[model samples]
Target: MMVRLGSSASRYVIATMAALALAACGGGGSSTPTPTPTPTPTPTSSTPVFTSPTTWSVDSGSSGVFYIATATGPAGKTLSFTITGGDDQSFFTVTSSGGLSFKSPPDFGNPQDANKDNVYVVQLTVTDGTTPVNQTVYVTVIKPDADVRVRRVGTGFNQPVYVYPVTDGSGRVYVVERTGRIKILDPKASNPAATTTLLDVSAEISTDGERGLLGFTLSPNFATDRTFYVFLTNASGAIEIRKYKTLASNNDQADTSTADVIMQIPHPRNAHYGGWIGFGADNYLYITTGDGGSPSDSDGNAQNKSSLLGKVLRIDPATDSFPNDANKDYAIPTGNPYATSGGAPEVIAYGFRNPKRASFEFATGLLIGDQGENSWEEADLLLPSDYGTAGTAPNFGWPILEGTHSFVGGDTTGLIPPILEYAHGTGGQQGSAIIGGYVYRGAVTSLQLNYYFGDAATGNVWSVPTQSIARGSTIKAENFRLRNGGFTPDVGTINNVVSFGQDNAANLYIVDADGDIFIVEKKPTA
Candidate 1:
């Protein structure tokens, strides 16, 4: 919501009609008794008339300080105004009547880089001691439309964190570009020419900043087993997931090669490796991992169900190796609530401090997004009958608790809370980190499909509807009457809203770390 600039004075009426036609051409052409022809006095252009209260709103609650007023020329004369763009203009307090109040600006830490749909042009000059008038404001800042739309398509991509898009049902999209390349766009090419580079892995991933080649999946029978899966971090930091087999003829992917590695996890800390992979609805293969980074959870590994880090794993991969005997490449779906207690049998939800993105609701398979820490940021729905047909055990409390409170005490009893929770401090408007998404079921959007997804480290985008959620017998969960809709995000710039895929035509895709790839449609309605 911080992409500001819309106080709307008829959209800045060309600097207020050229400052009222230069104040009616400097008024004065007298002739009293006889001394008449004394004209030629034209030099009075004093423009600086920005009246007060065009629009302003404030409500920070947990704190104080909010004064507004910023005057400059016109009414009386001697104009003066100077309160440029923002970044905390000393917290703001301009009153000579031009009013400009402020006191709540830092909590956006990185909220998707405060997206104004990628627009930045700020100017506010109004002086009249010697004439100077300029006005150009156009700040949009959006993020809450969710038919996803990270679109940048492709480029050289060096710090390209993660993209993961896969579509092959015809219009050809397949993105995946976390420096370990793979970019093919082909909207039926002839000259579609948007982005291309099937797969590279920069000689085996590891591009840093939370490590690269983050996650991808495409093998629910990719038309005819073109097979795919990736979740990298390799080059020594560890976390691998590997598996590929494309060959290229028309699927457009060209060469893939390696066919199996399935799992790794070492990660001595390059950054929270909550990689994020999907294939839920029982086809088995759901991963999320992160308590391995720094900050609070230090080494308790987010509740240590025998260290899979923060945990959410459920792999089966259909075999290539690494199954039984504890852990190697994958297997462990025997319902996994810690399968047999010795621990790492592929966990299946345990505490979690960085469950980046987990979605599945292609018509009520439930299992929604997760991301909570610091002050709060969560969203969950689960319920495939509570994961019994296979994919069981779900605790999700983390470091004793966070969205319901109790940061480090123990026994949150049955755990599992959060149907929605936001607030990261700084007078609390919300958002620090939590970018989980998807619950649109797109065909073009009528909207209420029980929406429940999130995003914000400043990337904005929010929705929380599954009827507003209630579920309470102590397992914790409550979110009522909520309605924060702003920033309409569906234009561009989306780094790390990571996983939201769906193809075979239910249509929905929003993967981004930098290797952009949007496509969430539904704004038509003429």
Candidate 2:
């Protein structure tokens, strides 16, 4: 190869040639700009990359697993995940693979330091080999007792059939036993320490099938008048509606001598002694009785106008105007459905085979649970003539049209169809017999304002939108399936739910024939 040399001078040219020849062989010049160096692209690690964090909550004593997105890259780089900034670090943890989970369940019942409810917060950091993205997460710890339970408020009640909490500021829940004794329960006590017999007519009433002291209620003027009412059957199977005065000295005791016999009607035969009574929103006394003590009503008592047997009788016990009042103790309200010529002035609605229970909501006339003979158990909604009036009308179709269909070959000419009816069966059966329940104006948010009634035989409780009925909507009372409002497991077992009653606070209580009282509260899981 020919050498090209740069000469400092002609004499130095020769030496330069030799140096240039050496440089060509791999020696470099100290001042020459060897072909401007090509610029390499930045390594791609400087840009920030990662997804935003999200928030979450979980019940205390429960495990929770959360997810995160796969991180982006800083060129050929992989991402790393981490967690930071959390209190009570023992309760939660995060894995390097972006999984957030509870290390241990948080106990809201026994909070670590504060009596107040707790919320756990933690930050998740996701890095893409270059920059990190931080997100905030919140986990809530819920109370252990927050989930409503069929809390036994009173136990060993000896056939507690009814629970009536008087609005007298006493916080006493009166439990009526089938053997005819009214027991008292303290609001502050769970199992009754000892049943204080508020009233003992145990020796007076018949406790045969569906007989005995069935149900009772406190007078609207109970606080001042100290009066309460009870429905019972005498030894002769005669239904008696009576009022007794509470002892001034003790809220749990009543004056036996103060018994004011409101009505005493002979219940013939002895099977369906329609045994339930309560004051309506109108403050008027409404009584429900069977079409006599027979199952078939072959005696035609349910359709007879003169008979109070199969009728819903409305009377103002204060006015004492009942046409058949033995003591002139109760006055008939101005507008009785059959006050003119149907059968009796005391008959508000006609044709009930064996109405186990009936209740009146000021907004929606009346809901009568008519126990069917064979096929249909009905919940009849009687609408008032003057939709203007609160609870007014409806002629229930008794033996003739048992639940929208013919039972004893009776015509439906004037029979009001049942708003709801369910056939008899065990699984989802409305139950063999229908026991009327109250419209829930209870404290449970999920079950609030819904009408809850159960079967005396099946313990199956069902609800219908009372508001829907109030609007007079076409929502017929067909046996609607039981709904726990998305709350878990069936409402425990009511064990022959004899009745449903509410405390002064509108907290609903279940009266089980098994001698226990259950209060329904808000379910935490809801």
Candidate 3:
């Protein structure tokens, strides 16, 4: 359609024509041109993730490849792995190939983790060119299923009470029989059944109840002196300590004419004869005695500093202190607790109740198995400072306190409690009699430096960390059979374990009341 222009339209057309004429002729004012803008590149998205599990189980005492880190990242993007944080990160070391391992082998018994638990935690980081990922890893250290078993070394004795290895470089062991016979047998022989009688005093000693040829030990100078000692009950029912000499011509026979009574204590009752004798590293004779054999120690023998019936008596058997008394031959050690004044000159420490078994641990300290009356059985430890003039002799709570529990009526003041104790019953934590064992310094790595003890009534063996005990930690005993259940097929339950013995190499043996001896061994892993 055609339209007519108004007056304002006519003016706009004239101005547009005049501006076009000036630009064509290059007659406009100074002008500026607009610059072009830079374009933004497209961003590439990346997601880094760990394909491995966050939880892992690492075998104790194993060193390599506990975990292998597997991860995924964006295609053609470089990926890296690193350990970033956590309490146990110092224990772990990672490889560029994603293999993770411990800096050293982890021990289950004494964990090196920050929390002292077997569980270890660590933070892991994986990074790509575009994205970074972090993961918290939890590694649980598991104990090795060690295979431990006992191999029978000998049998056919009359209630063998102890097996003492001969220190004369003979490789023979002296087996003590409760029927008043001490037999020498070669455990490594092709026929271990052949035993030679070293001493037989069945006619001179009484063997009625808890009495017999109970304890024996070779002198530390036996190789040169050819001397040994024995503990037994005399015809009058008193505990007798005697000394004898071996024949110069025969190592297996004791010279009957050389037998002499060293000392005798009046033990009227028919039970609780302590009778455990051994030579300490100081070469002094150490003898253990019971509290004169009455329930709850009614005679008050253990607490009486003047009485020798319930004390650990240390003496120098080479010299005589009681020269006037023919029976009292031994001289008290110089550093004995009572050697100067308060109690019997031979008494080193007091307060013991039926410490039937005792041993020195790796030439360091004394370990005693004190049988409780009604409720508990305990293991007592005497450190280096607790004996021999250190003036720290601990009064092991006997009548006053039985295994950390206060008994009927006695002063509990200044009493040193037992380091380990168990209740009375047939369960895991209970046993009638506690047979204390030696601190294992043997070839078995799993049982290294552990104090092995057991119950005589149940024949269940247990162990505690000796290092922890030395550090003054009262730790719970671990059941040996339950903890190392991977025993060999031929191994079975040990019945009536009366005592434990050790050879010169520190190899441990279990002595059965039914006349069997077993050597504890650990089968090698394949």
Candidate 4:
């Protein structure tokens, strides 16, 4: 070290001498080393990821492979994908081609369909062989408690039990009151309301429990023929299907004077008046009749091929010939099973408890909701294989067999078992009556052409695979919640699901005994 000099010239001389001394000693003294630079990492996508639906409708069978997701990794780079989450990640996978597929089909049942287990909360990690990019996403599965809902649309009617739509290209819907009045509704109106009375038969009909104008259907040629039919319990308690034509001046108003008693069946008992009429694609009138009313079916009406009481009858009331039959009101179709069997020519199929509701599936033939006696309620899937081919339409086991279970001395031999059945008082609700509905051949994509039906007492709705019905597969149904508020109603509080109806657009509606109606709708977000 050099000491400070007193003068500037002396300080300059000392500094130059010190620098020369330090430079000569540098090779011998300790020296500091510089650090190696850290090269900046090659830039890549901030978050390279894939996309999938928020939810997916589980398929009916194991064979259907639905695309669930797709991805595109970093450009000009190879991608290696792996997903990790859920009980088994094998159910969902990401392919090297960036396509996602369902490896395992989901069954809408317990454990496999539980809320927690039904979701795949996967961490998608994609690698370009050097660095990995990660993303998290959720894909929900449809189980018994599906993501769909039933929303209330109309309320405050006089004990409305059924609502129907006329596919007559008029965009008009009719509401039938248990009080014996029919009202017209413009369904497409922003706030659809029924204000006009189309027909009133309160003076001629008796309105009571399990009785009244139970069935109504438009004639196939209603757009031109202007004819329709109403099945009702007249003041004398006789079940009648009477024909009426719309007034020429007003399509909404019918000519009461032109009411012709088409066909009337005597079901004097107060219970089990099967009152559901639907025109098949063949244009023949098909009607469902309950086993002559009583607790255990004291009279074997359903088993008897001689009576029209507990049977599905196919007749052509449009002709009004009545040439050979005893009642001579309507002509039996030549295609009926009993037409040549020396049996009641009106009987198309027999053995029903209370075939409460029936409707065609458009492409497939028929589906019937049969009310149970004590334990089970069933939805019957009828096809040409079931009816048009053989001995007769399938004989649904009623008193003979409640569901697939044997009952008190009930006949199980040669009986067609229900495709699906649940215990009545299960899941904190009771299934008192089953209201059969249409297969959802509607605009809702998630519904997947499913058959929608529900229990009247529980207000719990369910959807079965319509395709499974065609393939004769026994896939169970997924349940839909029908609540009071937008999504929540008091448990077991649907009043009474009296009947289900569908419109020309294939949209479905529910009628209740509490004088209200609800429309089944899909979730846009879900």
- Scored by TM-score, the top model is 3
Ranking by TM-score: 3, 4, 2, 1
Residues 1-526 of candidate 2 have per-residue lDDT tens digits of 1111112112111111222333344537667656766999766545445543354433444433423333555666567777766554455576665656666655666666222457666767777655777766665554543445556667787777777775667666778888988887875563454567788999988887778898798888877888888889889888888888988887568999888878788778667877778887678787888887675787888878788898877777766655575644776676775555545666777788777776665433567788888866777765444222323345677888877777777456545666667656553333678877777655565565567777777676667664444221233323243532222223344657777777777677777787767777665463
lDDT of 2: 0.66
The per-prediction tally of clashing pairs is 29, 15, 0, 0
Please identify model 4 stretches exceeding 4 Å from their true place. 1-151, 168-170, 190-193, 323-327, 389-393, 426-430, 470-495, 522-526
**What does candidate 1's lDDT look like per residue over 292-394, in tens digits?**
7767685788787778888777778876345463326666666666566656777766777776666665423334455665767665555433445332466
Candidate 1 error regions (>4 Å): 1-151, 154-173, 176-183, 186-227, 230-244, 248-286, 289-341, 345-350, 357-370, 377-399, 403-405, 411-433, 436-526
The residue-by-residue lDDT of candidate 3 on 256-320, one tens digit each, is 99988999899969788887999988888888898988889999998888888777888899998
Residues 1-526 of candidate 4 have per-residue lDDT tens digits of 2211112211111222233333442333446554566999987664455543333333222222233334455778766667754444556666654344455554535334324565655556666776666665554544432544555666667877677886766655688887888887665555544457878898999877688877888898888889889888898888888889989988789899989887878885888877888788788888999987877777888888888887888898867566555445677777777776757887777888888788876433567888887877777755544556424656776777777777656556567766566556533123667888776655566664566777777665566554345222233322332222222221223546778887777677777778767666564473
Residue 135's lDDT within candidate 1 is 50
The C-alpha lDDT values of all candidates are 0.55, 0.66, 0.75, 0.65
> Cα lDDT of model 1 overall?
0.55
Who is ahead in TM-score, 2 or 4? 4
What TM-score would you give candidate 3 relative to the actual structure? Answer: 0.70
Lowest summed lDDT across 10 adjacent residues in model 3 is found at 9-18
